[model samples]
Target chain A: MDLKTLTIVVVVASFILYIAIAIWAKARSTGDFYVAGKGVHPIANGMATAADWMSAASFISLAGIISFAGYDSSVYLMGWTGGYVLLALLLAPYLRKFGKFTVPEFIGDRYYSKTAKVVAVICLIIISFTYVAGQMRGVGIVFSRFLEVEILTGLIIGMGIVFFYAVLGGMKGITYTQVAQYCVLIFAYMVPAIFISVQITGNPIPQLAFGSNLAGQDISLLAKLDEIVTMLGFNAFTAGSKSTTDLLFITAALMVGTAGLPHVIVRFFTVPKVSDARKSAGWALLFIAILYTTAPAVGSLARLNLINTIQPGEVGAVDGNLKYSDKPSWFATWEKTGLLTFDDKNGDGRIQYYNDKNESFKAKADSYGWKGNELKVDRDIMVLANPEIAQLPNWVIALIAAGGIAAALSTAAGLLLVISSSISHDLVKGIIAPEISEKKELFIGRVSAAVAILIAGYLGANPPGFVAQVVALAFGLAASSLFPAILLGIFNKRVNKTGAVAGMIVGIVFTLSYIIYFKFMHLELNNADNWWFGISPEGIGSLGMIFNFVVALVVSKVTEEPPQEIQDLVESIRIPKEV
Target chain B: MSSKENREAYWKANLKLMGLLLSIWFIVSYVLGIVLVDQLNTIQFGGFKLGFWIAQQGSMYVYLILIFVYAKKMNTLDKKYGVED
Candidate 1:
């Protein structure tokens, strides 16, 4: 079957599967809606968490980032996975024992202040909304490409599917559906990767294939890639152009941010026991690692393949250049999407995929009788275009399309769930009308989810930046604000209401302002001229988190400790068997 | 048994294990991946520098193992303190 037909079939099948799970797992009570009835098996929860955690950023853009960013990009791999360790060790188990339905619920009770709960609700909404918008955009892109639909139309359909299941099943439906999604997405991701790995290195495991010697080469795959790229005036595949300090701060920020994300942290609350939360985190990481470990390999191999295709046969010479007519089927396919474009500005028949903008490289290309740069490859196309580059079977390509959609939709549903619950349960019921019946609350939750989906879909239609960049912003906000507040509330019993509230406000304000100033307001200033203390807006959020920690400590010391009843609540949450 | 003594023992053992695991975590990620990476680059594994391997793959594998090990150890501790679920 053709790509369009296959994509439609896969999407329809997934929709039906999601609806089936939602109906089967329809939440009966507030408890079922919030925590999946707190009976999810550890491994099952792990799979769901993996699906939830991977997001559109992981499935679609991580490889793309690594593909271009080269060795410095290892920070993403380390930072993302390492954060799970912090989550598992520092936060997950205790939150599980806290036995709360929502993150705000935990904060409000622990801090003995409704104001703290409200602040957390605001932060959760902001973080989850920022994240969900990216997922919706991801779905739209996949739909536009594979299903031959307008981007907005694709987003609406994705929104509808997310709405149906998420509204009906809540966390219960989302959990089970995420299990199915994890299976589809992981299989979709790895099949193309494995095929490419075997084709390039005669190895099935991408992680090993990355390091193995290329067929008919003396050097390893990375060394070969490095040689070709540098020959073409690109950076080496295994070395980075970013400063070590910048890399360290960026990686640290991402790690802290991952541990702080509300959607990911809330997954721990679904498990039955504190120990299960701990175990579930491990299982989740193992599942994530399956893709994370393979991704760099995929990125490196794709970079090599791209360079080799554009410059076939020889190194840095006119005779080695790939003729426009000789471009592969994959090149033509991506070119149609405008993600891969070529313009022979000098009217040469050959395609020059080099950094012609580099003054030194331009001089060399001129001397070599090369035209202007021919290939304008969009980094976003790397993973989606990989299977085609390797000339893999049509089914693998179809699976990739399906997998990308699944990854996006699964995360969209999870984030939408959080947004809806915060509005319906936390704001409306918990604060507005605590006496509302379960049925009424469920009705409100469904409506809120549908509305949230519509708003998210609209924002996604006109994304401000790349999906991963937007996700990073969301993570930074969460790390600096919500994560710190939640952690302090549980672990530091002396953090009174005033302290928690002050800390969250300060952290969120600092991080958000830094991002807005750098990303939106500082266009006139060179990057080197703007950022304070060499901390780019991306990494400055870590400083915000530190500020939060200090302010909370100092404020709590000056203020009275939480009341006796709140102290008992803290002690109870720390104990394993009590809840 | 007094709840105070039981809670103290449970938390003490848990904190002790956390300290040990956290130290390993720091060593693998910061020590191997960053601080000592240059020194360890001379040591090779397959085709990768040893420090690079730790930065990319080894630390993640260790983190996964750490969680399971911590869980198992904590479970045993929970039982010892009569706090097992």
Candidate 2:
């Protein structure tokens, strides 16, 4: 069969498998629907969390972002995976010992206030919605590129799949399906990486190849990449251009936010015991690290391959650039998707791919008769186009398409579950109608899930802004608001309901206004110079988290202490054994 | 010791363990990976600059180890305190 036919078969097979699992493990009660009956084995929960955590951002855009930004993107590499350490050490076991169905439940009970639960529910809703939007966009990208469908059509199809499982199986169904997705995505990611590693560095392991010499060449890969990119006026591949302070703050914000995310924290609730929670976090990070470690290698290798393909000879030489007619089949293929475009600025009928915006490079470019950079490549296309660029087999290309969809759908389903549970369990049942029956609550959960999918699908069709930037905002919100409240609730017994509530309000409000004023209201002034303390909007959450810590401490000191029962509750969660 | 005294001692030990482990965690990723990156980059490690390798690869490995070690140590502490489930 041809590539298109084969891609359809693989993608369809995966979908059918997921639907079957959803049916077989369909939720029977609110217990199963919300927390998988709290019976998930540690290892299974770990695999599911890995799939739920590595969204379209990690599978599709991350390598591309790393490739273009070079060493400056280490913030993502370390920031994302390092958060698991915080989750494992600081949060997971205690939350599991609390044995709650949702993150907001713990906050409400610990703070002894209905208002605190409501505040947490709102934060969860905002963070999950912002996050789910990015996943929908990922689904659209995969569908449009591989399945040759319109973005809206792709999103509708994605919504249909998520609605069926998420509405029916709830957390139980999502968990099993996610386990399958983790297998599919990791296989799809590694196969191409291994092939490319062998092709470029004669090494089977991409991580080893990252630092090793190119095949039959004496110079190491990073050194060669640095040489080529610098010659083209781009920053060195192994050196960072971002200030150290910005990197520090950005990395910390991402770490804290990852730990604070409701979707991630809820996964720990599915485990059977407190010890299992810590063990599963370890397993989840190990599985996630498999992909995280390989990403930088894939990024650098892809960058090196792209530059060699574009400029086959000396950088400044007139005959060096590839002729338009001689461009590779992959170039033509990606160009049709409107993601990769070429412009003959000098009408030279050849490609010039360089940093033309570099002031120092402009004089040399003029001397070479090059009008400007003639190629524009979107960063999101790097991983999706990698197999084609490397001339890998057609099957590998098909696998990547399925893998991208799986990553996006898995995370989207997880977020939708969180959003739905927040509305049905936290809002309607916890506050609005405390006397509701379990059966009625389960029905509400399913309906809300379906509605959330529809809303998420609509947003996917009409994305609010750049997917990465929106995702950063989601993390910042989670870090500033939920993380501090949840951390204080468990770690500090002195923080009263009023203190916790005030801290969350101050943290989220301050962070949101700062982001809006800089990012949306004053777009033209959203640079490093205009930022407070040289911190970008992306890194502002770290400072907000600090503010939350300070406000909670001071406010609690000035007010009455938390009741004795609340202190007992805090002491109870700190231990592994149930009293 | 009374049950309350046992609980307090276990909590104190847990705090001590966390402080030590968290210190290592901070030093690996934040100190070596970011703060001292420029100075460490002068030292090469096979195919990588020492700092870049630590940031992208070494810190992650250390993070994995830190979690497992904490878990193992906590398990022992729980058993010793007669709190194992």
**Highest-scoring model, DockQ:** 2
Score every model by TM-score. Answer: 0.97, 0.99
Candidate 1: give the TM-score of chain A: 0.97
Clashes of 2: 0
Off by over 4 Å in 2: A466-468
**Tens digit per residue, CA lDDT, model 1, A1-579:** 777787678778877887898899988887888789999999999999999989877898888888888777778888899888889888999999988788888888888778999999999988898788888888999999988899999988888888888888989999999999999999999998988899989888988897899977678887677778888788776666665666667777888899988788889999999889999999999999999998888888888888888888785665688889988888888889999999987677888778776777878888877767777988877898888888887778888888998899888888888888888888999899999998899889888988998899888887766555556788788888987887887677788989889999999999888887777677566285567767777777788898888888899999897899988887777778851
Instruction: Quickly count the clashes in candidate 1.
Output: 0
> Residues A97-198, candidate 2, lDDT per residue (tens digit)?
998789999999999999999999998998999899989988988988898888888898899999999999999999999999999999999999999999
Count of backbone clashes, every candidate in sequence = 0, 0
Which pairs clash in model 1?
Answer: none
- Number of the top lDDT candidate: 2
Give the C-alpha miss distance for residue A566 in model 2, angstroms: 0.7
Which CAPRI quality tier does the interface of model 1 achieve?
Answer: medium
DockQ for every prediction shown:
0.61, 0.77
